[model samples]
Target chain A: MTSDITLILRFLSILGGGAMAGILGSLTGLGGATVLVPLLTLFYGIPIYFATGASLISTIATSAGSASGYTKHKIANIKIGVGLEIATTAGAIVGSLTIVAVHEAHASWIIYVLFGIVLLGSLIPTIQRSSSEEPLKRKPDWTTRIFQLAGEYYDTKLKKKISYEGVRWWLAEIIMFFAGVISGLLGIGSGALKVLGMDWAMNLPMKVTTTTSNFMIGITAATGSSIYWYEGYIQLFIAGATAIGVVIGAYIGSRLLLKITNKNIRWIFFSILSFLGVEMLLEGLDKAKVLVIATTIEEMISIAVAIIMISGLYLKTRRGERAVKAA
Target chain B: MNVPSKQRDIDSITSLILRVGVLSSLSLIIVGVILLFIRGSADGVSISQIASFHSTFNSSYLNPTHIVQGLIAVDPLYFITLGLWVLIFTPITVVFTSMVTFITAGNRLYIAMSLIVLFNLFFAMLAIPSLIHT
Candidate 1:
């Protein structure tokens, strides 16, 4: 009975967290983390480290969920995302290796600094007025110019042609380089940087900027995630729960977008996240002492179960490989 | 002379739809790039956004052996081999992956419900000069 209640509570927290993440994530263009991580840690009393691990799972979930919607709409720009991924993925590996090295030293200060930064960011609105008004000057780049990197988007509202030329590809590359480094080093995604890089240097439209930033995050996170797993930072049970929740949340949220006005959605969404962001900042500050939980038997079982699944996959792969050889 | 519609036609239509879908996604990426540039300096874009989330959660990820590292005596250097795959396929895979997602979740009912809310929001937001400017 006690276990049942814990499970129920767990389910509810994740569901609620996911719901909040979906609404606010779409609104703020900051993805779901703007609300999820804080909701888990501050409201539900999930630890920050654990919350972050869980956040990564949800982040991937939201990405996966949105990937389908964006694909249906034909707006994800997989080519550009893929091209930039080469740089980001490589950087993630190095970033993960760095985190593993730093784990031994035990840095809480870094989290504090990161929290301060997010607190500062959460308050600010996603400024877009100038984005529409300014006559964009495409910063010349050999790669962008040669490749005709500029692209166009239809304003659903304006119902007219809105086009932009590529800005400073070199600058974007450099920003991604650092973003990748941070992705691995902190076990945090590089969406913030990728969005910023493309925006400031490339001059993409706002929706396009937000979506592509979302597009580019998968590889970087996946790269860093692989490294983090080897070094033993992720707790599978927590991550699994979080991942499932976020995927569902993002799906529902995007679907809800169909009903909600984008402007109202953005306003309500940012307002909620901003509220949650402040709450998170306060909780993080109040709790100075850190508590590290031991990995549970449930997680061990989860890993064991996964191993069984992998062995099955391996046998299949071997049989396929052998058949090819025979052919 | 006009040809009759057939299963092949539906398949071809779907394929074209998929192509257009991917093209649209690519277009959004382009637009998104411009939005980011006009908003602020590139450094501010990603770093601050990332810091915003990281600061809130500050986590250490777990290292999984078999799943990530692939330790169970497969081919030699399996992880290295997988890393090679990541090197090649991450970007394009997301596109292909999106198509799969649409097929799995492509219900007109769900999509339509979601859009009613989405488009109205975007129309009002985009048309209003005040929100666009600030």
Candidate 2:
């Protein structure tokens, strides 16, 4: 338990995984903890309980690092974000309380199953809008005017200032509450759900959806993490390594984001989501004795499914492009 | 024009606070990790033991006073833990700053919303957690 060499190796390996998760998280607007949780649980053989704590702490790290840049650029709508935080922080309290019961009962399979479903479900919207960075234009509603949910940012990709207004503030708040609950229970930033709340329900631009979600995630994660801290879920060495590594990795990812096109990045993000979703589902099923297979075999099956899904996505996009040209 | 310019000032200040809070915490965490490895242990717990997921070191026992005491003793784990706390508190700090920002901007709606967020944060971070644990 006290070996020096083993300790160094563990630190390096966790750091590497956290870094990769950070890059994926920044590109996808899913916090690094989303990918990092699955990696620790499946690949590193860490307990899901401990992996969650590490993931939660690392999410704060990633969010804080990235939120600085997004807020500075004035893309993150502080007014809208704080308005929604009222709901999210309240939901986080409820989630943390619920998890204490779940943890006591040792019903972790439920978490894995839910995580799998959420990831798989989110992929649809990700794929549907992968080609278009512009959000669907919708007229501002009464909630929008009241909440002052409007902003303008210069899009480097479009090379012009784009002004957009968000509608359905109440809808965004409803979604944020659940997003916070998920963050508390799963120890993730739940940034994907936050993005969905704004991008889909509120009719915000993708750039704003992403940056604002990034800004909002820090508060939600913090609300959850304080509870995790009290519940004794955090391991100092593992969580610390993960947080530091993910921060460094997210920094690199934000730099790379300027050069890479969103479409290419979306593909990479979707593939990772598919692979992790299948892995979590199979693992949960196996744990529940619904089916049994060697862990290696499960990993292989997940890889195969990911490859097939990615290829199918590629073909569909290509066909769509062709149809658009042919028309 | 006046409102937009004032808003931008608040935004820039808020950004500076976030950058400092995050970067400093990261550095503290990194240093703490290095100390754990180089020292081969912290507070008599070996690095390998701490690195292991199953290590029985319960951070729940580390209250603010204990954390401060640990810091005095140069405990690597405490340093790392403090860093994590800093990371968590960063957003809460931002909420407070925003409250003040809204107050100065005379945005009554946002001030009320920010007050709710701040209340929730304090209740979660301090009041309820202590009540539950005790």
Please report the candidate that would top lDDT against the real structure.
2
Docking class of 2: medium
In model 2, where do residues sit more than 4 Å from their true spots? Answer: B1-3
Question: Tens digits of per-residue lDDT for model 2 on A264-315?
Answer: 7888888889999999999888887888999899989999999999899889
Best by TM-score: 2
The TM-scores, chain A only, for the candidates as listed are 0.74, 0.95
Against the true structure, candidate 1 reaches a TM-score of 0.59
lDDT of 1 by residue, A1-327 (tens): 564445445545666666667545644445565566656665666545555555554554455455556544444444355445656655665665555455556754354345535533533324232324233676656767654466655555555556666667667778777777766664455466776777666776655666667656654565555344334344333444455455556666666653454445534544454444444444434343442223253234334544554455446546765887799
Residue-level lDDT tens digits of model 2 in B6-54: 7788788778888888888888888888878778888877666777778
DockQ of each: 0.03, 0.76
Per-model TM values vs. the true structure: 0.59, 0.95
In model 2, state the lDDT of residue A250: 83
Best by DockQ: 2
List the global CA lDDT of all models: 0.48, 0.83
